[model samples]
Target: MKILFVCLGNICRSPVLEAVLRAHAEKAGLDWEIASCGTGDWHLGHGADPRSRASAQRRGYSLAAHRARQLCAADFRRYDWLLAADRSNLAEIVRRRPADATARVALALAHAGLPQPLDVPDPYYGNAEGFEAVVDLAEAIARAIVARDAE
Candidate 1:
């Protein structure tokens, strides 16, 4: 399965989801292709935010090699799933999806059976605690994705 995570900026939430889910996918022996992108292009080509990287690191997850990229039309055709961090981003993705696209786009948090269609709060302008919260959410969503793939 191919999965893409999307956020306003690729530096925080989406990268965390990609890293966390990739680890879960690997451990489950699932050959899932996982990547992340942003709705905005501001952070294109930059690595994940240091705070996000550190939060993932604390949990033994790595965002070291993650580079920010903006979502494009081609991605709608390339991935099986496009998981958005928040409602606005999801709406933007839906608006940009090609007519012939096959990707299933939705909020990443919902896949985890969390609050129905909840937005994984953006941690970019907050403190370390915010990033930590994102890690927690990412881990849960990763496990959920693996479980779904297993089924």
Candidate 2:
């Protein structure tokens, strides 16, 4: 299974989700391929935000080598799933997805069993606490994905 996580910018939410989900999949012995990208091109080729990297490190996940990339039409054909961090990103992804693409696109939290999907908030302008919150959400989402796949 190949999964691609998306957000407005690759520097924060999407990259964090990529790292968290990859860790969970690896620990579960799943052979899933995971990656992340942003709808915008602003941070392309740049590493994740400093605060995001620091917050992830505190939770034992590394964002040390994560580089931001912009989402492209080809990604829809490459990944099995495209998981958006928030509703806005999800909408944009759907709008931009190729007509013949085979990827399933949805909010990352959709399978978490929540009554309603929750958007993974952008923490770029906030302090460490915001990033910490993102970690909490990312862990939950990762576990949910792993559990669902196991079933």
Candidate 3:
């Protein structure tokens, strides 16, 4: 299965989600392809934010090699699942979706059975704690996806 995680900037939430999901999938012995992107191209080619990376590192996940990139039309055709961090990101991705693509797009948090499918708050303008929260949410959702893939 191919999964793509997406966020607003790709430097914080999406990259972290990609790393977490990759680790979980590997541990579960699932043959899955995982990647991430952003709805906007503002941070294209940039490494994840320092705080975001630090937060993920604390949780035993690495975002060091992740570079920001924008969601593209081909992505809809390339991935089996398109997991967005929030509603806005989901909306942006849906707006660009190709009619014939078979990819299933939805919020990652919702896949995890989150009570509220709200936006995964952007940590770019926040502090370390904010980044940590993002990591926590990402980890939860990643695990959920891994579990579902197992079945």
**Cα lDDT computed for each candidate against the true fold:** 0.92, 0.91, 0.88
For candidate 1, lDDT tens digit of each residue in 1-151? 9999999989999999999999998999998899999999999999999999999999999999999999999998999999999999999998998899989998898866776539999988899999999999998898887887778
Give lDDT tens digits, candidate 3, residues 1-151. 9999999989999999899989999999988999999989899999999998899999999988988999988899999999889888888888999888889998888866775647788888878889999988888887787777689
Backbone clashes for every candidate come to 0, 0, 0
RMSD of 3: 1.2
TM, every model: 0.96, 0.96, 0.95
| lDDT winner | 1
Write down the TM-score for model 1: 0.96
Q: Which portions of model 2 show Cα errors greater than 4 Å?
A: 115-117
- Give residue 75's lDDT in candidate 3 (0 to 100): 90
Q: Is candidate 1 or candidate 3 better by TM-score?
A: 1
- The candidate, 2 or 3, that scores higher on TM-score is 2
For model 2, give the 10-residue run with minimal summed lDDT.
Answer: 109-118
